[model samples]
Target: RSPSLNLSFLYFCQLMATRGRGRGRVGRGGRAGRGGRGGDQQPDPLNQQQPPIFQQPPPHQHPPVFQQPPPNQGQNHVQIMGQFRVLSPPTFTGADGPQAVDDWFMNLERIFEVLNYSDQEKIVCSRFQMIGDAGRWWSDVWRLKTTAERDAMTWEQMKLLISERYYPYHFREQMERQFYALQQGNLSVEEYEREFTRLSHFAPHMVDTDFKKSRRFLNGLQKDLRFVLSSHGYLTYAETILRAQQIAASQRLELDAAQQTVAQPRMIQPVSVQPPSFQPVQVQPAVYQQSSAQPSGSGGKRNFEGKKKKNQQNKKGGNGGRGDRQPAQQTPRARPP
Candidate 1:
């Protein structure tokens, strides 16, 4: 062989040795080395098991997707409910008047304010409190709404719905009238203010402003209190109430003082006069005089005797004789047999 031929043979041998080393490396770890066909007979791609072509996930098997709630959502809900029940919230049954419904709403609002509840939370809490007729009514109302509408329901909307059902228009009108006619006649200042505040809800437009509220409150006050408060410039409702209370207290004190200072009428003791003593006069018995001579039956005979006697007396006087006149003889009367 020529020198070029020998050089070619040596290059071929080096090439073969490099290829053998490459094959050994592949046989140790490459796919073809792992019990696969050792040659360039690349396993038929069609027959080779490809990594499961990532088969389009079965209709049921979806990609890892996330939902709205976390794994501990139920636990969180239970915790919230536990906290809510601790407040001792009030319930409703639609068995009372419109006022009762309003009171229930007010009570719930107070509790909600303390809890800082959101509108949806308020709706949830309020619904949980409904029972009996109230629960049934809410069910009907709820059935009328779509899921979106239900989810979007706000606290005010819930109140309005309950109001519409339990608090009818006529009843609300009546309450408004009562609110307008409310007076502080016999109620104390605090009591009157409380009542006024409560009824004010029925006619919100009437007392929309402080001036109107003050005016309305003044109008309902007693005549004396109203008179005293009316003389000053406009005041807020609270200020007016405070002033009226002060005036009322002063008036009561004045009345008490006047009562204490007033002197009670003195009871007069009746004068007893002793009656005059009566003196009895002693009466004397009359004495009886008996005549010595009996009466004569003949009146003529007695007259003749009397004339004779008188004549005798005159003769004696004429002769100046001191002779005594003799008594005439009396004739006795005979008794009839």
Candidate 2:
């Protein structure tokens, strides 16, 4: 019993020592944590609790400070497919021109509606012209003119300007090759130029330049429609216009005929006829007629005849004598057809 009690006492002492060591370690750890978290101080390296520096935000992560732009910032060249191109026509001073040359073609497209060009020829041609001319006009400022100068330009000059300046770069490049080929005696400039000009006329962008001149050109070409048919392409826009116009005229004639048919007066028919009325004829009573014939009974013929003469006289006077000659009531009658 004595040895067992001694062993129990030894176990209690060991347990108390273990508890004291654990409390001392915990208190030291708490002091270290509080010291590392002190205000206005960084944590000690050994005691640092946050994620590593690499995991934290970089010093340059903040946005750049705001600054005033330079005076001409608005006119800066806009980037296009890695190339910076002028944003607007240098002549234009307002907000920079639309982002793409397609905007310029939009004006031509709008005009296409008014010109009644529904086929793809004008659309494709005008777009090519718009894209081509932007590059050309960008390189050459003199090509654009004041409104007055544009208005004063002759139709021939306008057509030449459009073909020379506004045609698509690829198409013009091909034309240049042919022009050089013609120069080398491989082809004739007149024939090739005529072909190129006729073909280029269908591009959508070409319509933006001198549309009135284009109409005139088409009209002139119509006189020599045989040449248009013989062209290498065998596709003439002049022919398209002629066809569209024929359709419009035919439609107009049809509409006019329809209007005439609508405007003609309509004939109305009578549904029924009214028959003539038959009225009853009132005849005098036999007794009244006999009395009138005799005229002799009121004690003597002279007295009765005197009364009859008086009644006759009253009726002739338009009085219809008061006591004995009331007017008869007549029935209503239908009108004759």
Candidate 3:
């Protein structure tokens, strides 16, 4: 009830308050709180100059913004759209010969277009790494090594270098000579014309006109077929070519027929049936001799009358002088005659 009792009560209350404060600062396992740990912990030598590790780094004046790259800047910061679909890169196998240039260049263009890298000269040069001749050609001839150098070079410069090594302009000259010099040879008309058309692509100026085309075709045609084609007065290359093909086909058919005949063994031809020969009739000359021996009617009558008269004369003379004169007269008359 006195001042002393009030002092005791106040002391107990302060102790109870102290205990509650301790419980608040300490964790459930009785581990020291963050403030206590700080007091107990040693100072880190590494963080002596810097702020505590727990302290957050100051916020940027603007937000922690990544600096966006400008348009057509480095590829690293570029955000490519998914809509730009890319196709597979084209490959060259080197089987197409010098004409490989067409495929290689065209394929490279297609790849570039698909990849949206039409302006990337470096990308184009880099693609040559896929070529079969890269080691031999792109390395040795051009003396190019680094990617930066290749990327810097223009495509034309690279193309000329390639052409110089593998296929030169002189190849075109050779093709020119070959085109004019091409004769039909043993090739069929259609085959020869096809070759002519393909070769003409190499030398378009040579046969640019239809007349030139026809002339070139006629010139290359076989000697046997040319004259016949020319006589037809063919005006266009198409007409000449068509006629030549027809002629060649006919000639080929004839040749096949002749070949077939020659290849077969020769057989003896059958003899034709003939009519029987007629026999000659025999005639005798004796028939005409017998007919002449037969006397005419008038001649026979005269002979009869003469015989009758001779008989009468003999009868009359017989009576008179027959006896004596008959023998002597017959003998003397015969001697006188």
Candidate 4:
């Protein structure tokens, strides 16, 4: 071979060796380096070292960046519902009367207050509790509203809607009449106050002010209580109620005490004993008279003879003895010898 040709062949062999070594280094790295001379060369998958079947992958130098998906609106609503149900909210059916609807609204509002619910949340929770006819009615109403309208609806607006449906004008009128006519009657102060508070909502215009409220409550009280309370100066409704209750309690206590006094048995005082008085009695003695005794038969014979002679002389001389009538002659008595 010629010398020049042999020299060129050696240079070409050296260049081929350098290129082959660079490819081996790249294969060892398991991937191509950045800014490689070749245009986007891919490493041979077969030549790359495979990780052990059971070996865990290397821990990330920086935690692998993960993009969080957006929150699901339906999931948020379900969570809210679950939280509301824990409070044991009351369910409503349109079959119940207007009073039931009112009571349901009151209860839901109380729960809403406790939970610090927003207006939207209140509307959502209220609609969730409705069932049966009430549910269907609300669904019908809801269907008529557009998305924007429904979203814009406030809790007060919802309440107005419900009221329009369940609480008719006639019913409200009847409630107002009853409220106006309400009297304490046989009801206790507490009970009358409860009824008054309940009915006041039906006729808000009448007792819009505290003074009007107090006056109205006073008017409904029992006659004696009203008369007593009417004499007092202006007072808040709460103060009036407290005073009335106190007076009633005091009166009841007095009545109970009087009844107890009457029911108790009376005590009788013991009578003093007196001794009997004794008086001495006087006695009278009997008196006896002594008679003169005549000598036996002689005296008796002489007296008899004299008495006979005197009697015969008196008869013969009738005119000698005072004027007329003759005396009767006496008979001589025989004497024992």
lDDT (0 to 1) per candidate: 0.82, 0.45, 0.67, 0.84
For 183-253, candidate 2 gives per-residue lDDT tens digits of 21232323433554544444435444555434433443333332443343333455544543454456569
* Superposed model 4: Cα runs more than 4 Å off: 1-70, 263-265, 269-337
Which order, best to worst by lDDT?
4, 1, 3, 2
Q: Against the hidden reference, what TM-scores do the models get?
A: 0.57, 0.17, 0.41, 0.57
Candidate 1 at 302: error in angstroms?
Answer: 36
> What is the per-residue lDDT of model 4 for residues 37-130, given as tens digits with 9 covering 90 to 100?
3435646444566553344566766657899997798887888898899999999997888988889988998888888988888888999889
Q: Which stretches of candidate 2 lie above 4 Å from their native place?
A: 1-90, 94-96, 99-235, 267-337
Candidate 3 C-alpha lDDT tens digits along 1-337: 9876787677657655644322223556765575464335444333356443244557765556798766774352233322222344455544457767655666666655666553354344344434665445555645545767655667666666666765568877788788978999999888998899867867889888999889988989999999888888756988898888889889989999999999999798989989899999898666544454338688788878887887778777775634224454444345654
Pairs clashing in candidate 1? none
What TM-score would candidate 2 get against the native?
A: 0.17
For residue 117, what is the lDDT in candidate 3? 50
For model 3 the local lDDT of residue 10 reads: 78
**Comparing 2 and 3 by lDDT, which wins?**
3
Residue-wise C-alpha lDDT for candidate 1, range 52-133, written one tens digit per residue: 4224658988688776766584676666667778999888999988889989988888888888888877877788889999
Of candidates 2 and 1, the better by lDDT: 1
